[model samples]
Target: MSKPKENIFDFKLFKRLFEYIKPYKLVFYSLIVLVILLAAFSAATPYLTKYAIDNSIITREEKDFLFYIVMMLGILVVSTVFQLLFIYYATWLGQNLVVDVRIKLFNHLLRFKMKYYDNSSVGVLITRAVTDMERIADIFGQGLFMIVRDLLTMAVVFGVMIYLNLKLSLIVFAMLPLLLYATRLFQKYMKKAFEEVRTEVSNLNSFVQERLTGMKILQLFTRENIEYDNFKAINERHKKGWLKTVWYNSIFFPIAELSASITIGLVAWYGGLNVVLNEGGVSQGDLVAFIMFIPMLFRPLRQIADKFNTLQMGMVAATRVFKVIDTTSQIDDHGTYIAENFEGAISFDKVYFNYVEDETVLKGISFDVEAGETIAIVGATGAGKSTIINLLSRFYEIKSGMITVDGIDIKDVTLASLRTQIAVVLQDVFLFADTIMNNITLNHPEITEAQVYQAAKDIGIHDFIMSLPNGYQYNVKERGVMLSSGQRQLISFLRAYVTNPSILVLDEATSSVDSYSEQLIQNATDKITKGRTSIVIAHRLATIQKADQIIVMDAGEIVEKGTHDELLKKENGYYKNLYEVQFLKEHVA
Candidate 1:
């Protein structure tokens, strides 16, 4: 398949990149000056040799020859000192600039709404932050410095050659246009190859992440061989892309080397013939200087070509990183309203929502829950039960209606303020790799140890946690993988209680736990819901039998809603049928 075409390396992006080095301008400029000095010293080496050959050795002036040798040694020492200083400062500048770029990019990414994360791959985003930034740093620290030094050396040497022997210099200059043409063609082919290599790398990273995360599922299904084959395919593709890039680079270098060799041979032939024919003939010293300058002239052309390749790779990586930084958050926080204390009353008025356009998930849903009321939402999968809680939490905006808390439309209150008043315990609980205490007190860091222990005790997990090797200080591995599903759910419940929010949302929070854990959660719920408005979405009908109101949803609307007794009184009601089916299954079991 043909790959997609991207624009060539953008000079505008390079300009913006340099702006990042502005804070270290003093160091950068010092490095530039050192580079020029080093190049000048290197260019002057040929002339020094010429002076020794013509004025010292030819005239048998041994003292003059020794003086010239000592001077050359001193220049070498100065060049070495300056070169070390430039390298130190340039490396320091590159490290600091990369640090700043990562910090800025990460801060911007964190400010983006949840939807942005939902749509982007975790692996690709991580690569942009780490691998891509490293490439840019290499370009600035090493590639950029080499280009500057080599170009300056080339220019000074060419100028000196023209002054000493114009005819030989012109003969050498005739090859310049050919070198330019060759560089342009090589760059065109090499850039495309490098871009493909980057894309393939990203894909490989994504595939690895997916497999690692889903290893449990793959093992459970005994699909290890299938996954291995899939991985091998992607790995081979990445290898092929890199091989193509290397191939292009390999071909370009030898061509440049051959061109340099041809130029050197022509200079020797012409300068030697001029001396023999005595037609403004070159001196032996002048001929040697011309030959020395030939290599210096062509060397920069090779360095420039290589630097262009590094630049292209860095540019491709920067484009990906900037794309993430430039993404516009779909959810806007424009509310001017602020609520110091909420009454916990929630109302949905003709609310409609859709994840996919033109396909409604919640249609004209209307409900009112007074402060301190416990409302149970019951529905089959895809019946809009979870959608209601998602909208209430402002995780998603309602499509065409108003959801209000404390009599003010939710859209008028800042998202932070609105979420602060709510606590959610979801089915798939997410726990960071940290101590148990940190996860429980995530929202309320100031909660005392006594309060944390009390919250864990209330949820009936206190004894289990205390029995662990480190008690509340016990480490939870990634996503709480160290704990069982029931244990994780209990910790999630404790986290919600520690927050002490005014409104509580439980979405299948107790479904994954064991019977013992469920009882503990029920007890905690009773204590926590004493004065707070609570909404529960559960598959188990018995769990919600005591709710103040039960909302039975079907498709995208509330088909039936009332107290359990009232719904059971109506023979054809959805709740009545669902309850009967569950009750029969329990009895049979």
Candidate 2:
């Protein structure tokens, strides 16, 4: 079951977010100083206007008018220069911060145990790493710096307003409480709405990603209408999420506009009374500057309220990204062994394992294969044949008991060392959409082109590759779709061989290949497994007939173990019956 799933204003989330910027502290601090200077410059503009009106424009002093004009133009030039610097540096800082964050989050994911990915969706993980990460970038690029700039601008503007005329400034500020309250309401509602929006985004992505990957099944089974209906429902939920945000925007902005308008109207009405009676000796310039200050102060308050949405979205995204970053379910790679050289001897002692509790898959099963020996595992579906292979490779943890290689406890060896010493070729071979050479060597810096060519030649696939349009450079397309199944398996064999691992695991590798490819694979198998330990899991009894030892499993237990002829000699043996049922039919056909 999924854990059921906030209040706004999470300082903890903000604290974690700001930590990313810590690496670029010099740029960040410089931005803050630039913003403070920018704010001071903006506050000076209205005062410049006031002086022009009082000392030059209205009084008809030509020299004073010229001086004020030149001074105001200089301020504008300075403000424009500062604004450009602000934009360039702010975006630079945001980009750097996110690059670091994305790398950090991705590196964190590399350490997570397989079970986390098994239970988590690729789409959700993509959302956290890519989409949510972008939102976090926006926080720095557009939200935090601008929020600081606006706040500082508002402070400086208000101070200037009070300095010009305190009575009118107080009246303008009276409208603040109403606007602040409206903004508070907006934040509360938007947090829940945006949360819904983000949740729906994950769900939608997961559904689409799954369907796209499995389009063949959907088309073959004719699930278009059913899946489309499911998609429609999810999409509607996403629509509703955004609509809730829109509804809040509709309600909140008007209240903010009304509050701002009321302050402007109050200044006009009350300032007229003062000027009429000459009550406070308020000059024409003072009243004019005071009116300009009203919006300068209040407009920022409104814009900051708007910018708060960006901040909130960022916080929401940061919370999700950090959740994955903070995950503690990890494979410990602290063992000292560094794969000095693997002898390939393997042992499974009283091993018990299960994917879920109370549903054991490998039930007290144990086995051993000496160095340079070949072991074959044959079993019915769900009898834990593949599960055993997964344990040997340490893909999944066993519930109980121990597995060892070369008399060393596998658990006490570093995962990199343990895995590097072994290679696996599964029945369903996967190849990247790249050149055959790349697929073979996987671009390992140490493996040279000559080494890859020699491995291919030794495996007898060199002539076949050379026959292609570009030989080894031919693009296999997605998952090697351009090649036959046998060709792909041959590639996997070459890949495994190039690594020269001590243990080679072929999990039903030859199951679905054509006869020609099977011949090629058999030849590759013989060449690679000459001096290495190999584990072959297959349904084809003939393939394992020459194995040094064969382990037949049934319902998670080893039912029989012996040489091929020895096991078949038993009249009522499980292997004998299985061979007659599966392998005999193939020969008869």
Candidate 3:
């Protein structure tokens, strides 16, 4: 188990966490009031018992004894009510505060650029959003409020003990330094232990999430045993992390109990001697109350140490969550362009881009497409074909170039308006684990059920969808695995069709589907591309033969451009060569 690199207990970190709690200040203030009342009642209990012993029982005063006993019972009842109120309200405050923080963090996550997700782990982020948030809630619900209550209890107990007998109180004070030292050690080591536990849990989450997502591959390749062994190792690390906290507890608790026992013993011995000597008039009642106060004082010290660990864990979690919320690397959607009636004329001027610095994927590439034009971009793998679509959609920022729609700089347009204007059907269709209808509409109220059904009908996928047990209401399950690849593609087409965007992008959309789905897609494509500006990134030479213009790219630069028939006339042209390899080879075989 490793320690965190950041400062373990930062006041600045805690101050930031409290901002989330500020909204519920009323509840917290009320909880604090209850805490103080509870402490006060507790302090009075020992005194009431002391008075009963001395002035009532020992003196054979029945009336005074009954009154004192009744008073103690009444105080206990009131204190319990306060404790219940504090617990419920404190928990409520914690839940509300965490809910707000989680919502804010998730909203912030949505704004981050695609590249951030590409480089980050989903499992780790989930842990931060879900598990880490819970840890922070523990600080409010169980940790900080408890700490405050304990400290106040200890303070009240100390004061009451001193008032009862100053000599016994002084003797009790002798053990304070040692207890404090033990608590300090417990907190320091436990902080590191909890940090390690969180880290290992995150690692385990990542490992399990990734493996389960790809479980099919593991079984298919007969690597289940290997993966299980790996999982066991990671799980062991998680277990070891928690065990370290247990180890710290084992060492600290016994020591704490021993110190507490010694305190009580010393108070008894010293108070007994004082009573025998009649020093400071230490009566049996006073000695009993002071002895009771010993446990009350020591209990808080132990509890405070435990609560501090929770506070520490929460601070660590908050730091992680803040790290995500604090991220500034997001797509700059500062563009002022609002497309009321967009003429989808797209142009790329001397564009250059690279996912990594000094490694250009698209180099000074320039192109033009008129509104309502069907331009097919064809290239071998890594020829920057899909990169063109990615840049046009503004998924990633271009290094140095101007991509424009209707001659308005894309960077000058708001992302929502720009994205709403374009519908992209990716090669690998992703369906949420939701009803088919919801997947198509994506909960867009404007696109109703009638519109979706009509769109599916128009795409010739209506009958196929209706054949399913639940029709369009069926849940696709994770990644749409329940449906065939072809069915998923049809759903995607329906999704795009209902959007009715000015620009439609189909990037290898029909490549992975079967012949039947391809034919259906071709028919849907013809209808969808009738007037919309469509960018078709395809490797299937047959699908794009009717394209108004075909741009052939090689090594990040356009190698050829013309109609299918015209490009075929050039004997050694890149497009001609590709068409022969893809189409002619199949016919020859």
lDDT computed for candidate 1: 0.84
Candidate 2 achieves a global lDDT of 0.87
Write model 3 residue lDDT over 78-140, tens digit each, in one string. Answer: 888888999999889989999999999999998887778988888999999999999989888
What is candidate 2's TM-score against the reference?
A: 0.96
Candidate 3: where is the Cα deviation over 4 Å? 1-8, 276-280, 587-589
> lDDT for each of the candidates?
0.84, 0.87, 0.89
Worst 10 residues of 1 by lDDT: 580-589
Q: What TM-score would each prediction reach against the true structure?
A: 0.94, 0.96, 0.97
Query: Which regions of candidate 2 fall more than 4 Å away from where they truly are?
Result: 1-7
Instruction: Please say which candidate is ahead in lDDT: 1 or 2.
Output: 2
Best-to-worst lDDT order: 3, 2, 1
Q: Tens-digit lDDT track for model 2 on 470-528?
A: 99999999889899888899889889989988999999999989888888888888888
Q: Score residue 4 of candidate 1 by CA lDDT.
A: 77
Error of 1 at 63 (Å): 2.6
- Candidates sorted on TM-score, descending: 3, 2, 1
| lDDT (Cα, tens digit) per residue for candidate 1, span 6-97 | 55558778788898999989988888899899888877778888888888977989999999899889888998898898788777877888
